[model samples]
Target: MPRKDTCKRRRIVLYAVRSAEFTTSDDRQTVYIVETDHDTYLFILFTSEVERNLYLYAREEEVSDEVKENFTNLANELSFDPEAITYLPKVPVPRRLPCLAPCDCPGDAPRVPSPPRRARPPDGLPRRPYGARSAQRQGLLFRQLFEAESFTYTYLLADPKTKEAVLIDPVLETAQRDTTLVKQLGLNLLYAVNTHCHTDHITGTGLLKQLLPGCRSVISRDSGASADILIREGHALKFGAFALEARSTPGHTDGCRTYVLNDQSMAFTGDALLIRGCGRTDFQQGSPEALYRSVREKIFTLPGDCLIYLAHDYTGQTISTMEEERTLNPRLTLPLEAFVELMNNSNLPKPKQIDFAVPANLKCGVQDVAV
Candidate 1:
């Protein structure tokens, strides 16, 4: 296409309220407003000189009374200069996506093993079933419920049609409870992910793979740990209902990973980005500088409205917004130079029994607990 035609595209972000279009190129995002559907274009002018020039030229021809009034009001109120481009290029679209796996019993199979079921109390309590669905399907949601044992939190995510789901970083001590939860929910156990193999967590995931057939185990590449599926910074998986994009965050562990779910302003920051600060950097292969870049570049750069759910928060806080973390986190608020100093200086205690706990975590959940 000719430069003139490409320039003619006149990228306009239609409305300022309830919607916004930020044209991004070369890793830089610019926020702008498009007031009209027609081809008329205007760039925000910060300086008085540019403002006058825009006003004079925009009203060069005989303009309608309403348009003239709008031009005057907008021009006067405009404070920041926004770049104008004609014929903004269309965003690249994702290609044909595959389906999610479901837990449908085979038709010819004899008495479908009535999987273990969770019995809810008849008492008048609202049964809240946590639902997860694959990005492939927009409206379909798979619902499940499991009591988070000790400090563990249960998460359900699946591909669109396969309706398959995976449990991430669950507690081991309560294996039967979670299995019952999965069976009651009618979800097939495809794979379980231990974001970073940690002992206090992941015991159940290992146990489930054996108790439930075909459920593979996955972990990060840098983690230096083994798994059925070894994923790294660039790996992605399509579960039956949802697809997850893996992000390598080194501070928590050399292999600590974060998963962005459904682009719905929600990311499962295994332990990298927590509500207050990121995971502690004193652990194996943990580096403060690497953690800083992970949060600043990979996590914080996203929309402020995105939701971040941390895996372990002994304090009982469930969730937090990216905006809050950006503004208030002590580690994030400080300069990177200062952060590195703190990561080195802070006198935080070591995780309670990692040496004994971690070796067992690598086993997926069947191994017995150490005294």
Candidate 2:
């Protein structure tokens, strides 16, 4: 007739909490007793917890309410008291020795983690699981975006069809996760393509070349600093029925390229067009006039419904459409006359490495940085 305090069942096992709380946008007072758990797990109780749960829910099979109901009904039939909650198994498990504090050891702190090793995926970049494309579609495959050698958003795009895949931009942290997922998905490397000459993003092209011996490398015209297949503007890369076209949008950088997956209505603008804005033009042989014309004359001219896929999101917002950007991006909407005037009057500070980076990026990011 009675039930145990199932209220104690917390989604997370945190050590402690005063209570749980949820807030409506602009309304922070509607706090509630979200489940409580152990202390170490408190980190999972923040707003980030919801994001983590959403990610996990996408990856794992969800527990259905039917199964839960059946389990409860069986327990009730067995006359199990729901009012009492007991967790102690009363069985001894192998105990692990606690690590002593390093006060007695000076060398402990010196053991810094070594740099992430390079990923050699035959010859291409590795892709990971990126969740659903839309509300009604299943997650075709996984995608992992990483900061590659040149600080590029290296991507691993998988083909759920043949379980074969390609890597877009694999930075060096990408190797660990890429190899793990590739093996997990039983996929093979097909090709590695660079949207264009990348400077800020880490370049894993070299690393991928080393790992994947036979994978083909696709680079926009004169992309690979050393050497590779030149992807001229409007080149169509066909994969079975799937194809991607290289749309040259030269303004942010001379060789900046955007790859459009026409079937998907999405164009991956490496650094040309971001989610809500455009990349800064203070770096790498940048000319504000050139950037203005590129965004106005080239990218903005695309179908208003074109979905823009950004490589960087410093502002946190993800993918958006050209229509949204047209209505929202101030930089893109500025009149030509005003744009030139603004640039002339703009006193924007130079990029961190303007002293040495600008010239380097123009040369396809072959910079000689002295560390």
Candidate 3:
């Protein structure tokens, strides 16, 4: 399969020709059929202007034998064909809905369309046998690391092409483990970025810099922590061809920032938002009002399909979607006033590590790096 970014630009173009017509056009256009739980989509790849013009002018055909056979087998298995094609299942064209496009092929075949529709699974067959990483995330190397002592999550994101990477919210005790993993993976660690200074645990950004030469520590300027790089909203931390766009979300801490990938497919939301709950706004300049707005405005505004990766997950849950959190978050669903009241009234005890952790994190977790 092609890279995820490449596939996103592909369009489903229907042509009247079949196996016999595969020889008509040049090698500039190729057809692909994708099957998902919701629907089946036909994709067209036009490599040159001449091929696109030919396809638009007369809807000529050209498909490799391997692809042609695959399409035929898939169509037969799914009971799909030109005449039976319908527009009910449409692939969203960005945000707009394109119902159909005119088909200029020889026969009276149905026009091409896209959408999201429910399709029943075959008898005794599961829609998806297991959960797996999406093909759309193909070119990106993403790892979710955990520190059991603090129940914290550290993220390692890298561009597979260049092996340039950044670690998000590394814990002090686990810094060596993370560093070893990076070296074993042959990656060039570029940045150890903290979303904010933490009260429960020290940040490994400072230790990571010591362990991995050339690695810089990044933190929001508002965090008031000592770091090699201080960033603000709209700052882009890049590694090779990819970048993490920072969005300041300062309710949990004055320095909390959410790092969203350039493609908007995933986000590293540290303490700002969680699977179903949110961070406590009881200390470190924490404010319910600011948090509510931060989550609703900064985090919720991302695409619904964007996956939410958190800095910490107390429960076993590790991931969520923007849509799920927007609709299902218990505290966020309430009116602003009610939400604020609930948060302000909670008398949760101070974290056990606050005294030492806060001071250590303020310096980016270097002095206590003995472990």
| C-alpha TM-scores of all predictions | 0.61, 0.55, 0.67
Model 2: per-residue Cα lDDT over 136-253, one tens digit each: 1322353646553334455565557776666665544465566566668776766667665555544444555555555556666634343355678878765433456787777666
Residue 32, candidate 3: Cα error in Å is 25
Ordered by lDDT, highest first, the candidates read 3, 1, 2
Residues 226-321, candidate 3: write the lDDT tens digits: 878889899999997788999989898999999998766678899999889999999999999999999999999775656788988888888887
Winner of 2 and 3 under lDDT: 3
Worst 10 residues of 2 by lDDT: 49-58
Error of 1 at 202 (Å): 4.9
lDDT of 1 by residue, 1-371 (tens): 11211111323222323122222221112222324545343332211100112212233354465655665565444421122212222222112110111213221112211112245445675222222432123433433333444465666665435557777776666656666767776767777777787745445666777666787777886776767888878577667535677888777688888877644345778778877877778867788999898888888865555557777776768767666798889888889999999888888876665776788766544354342
Clashes of 2: 41
Off by over 4 Å in 2: 1-131, 135-152, 222-224, 344-371
C-alpha RMSD in Å of predicted model 2 compared with the true structure: 20.4
lDDT of 2 at 77: 36
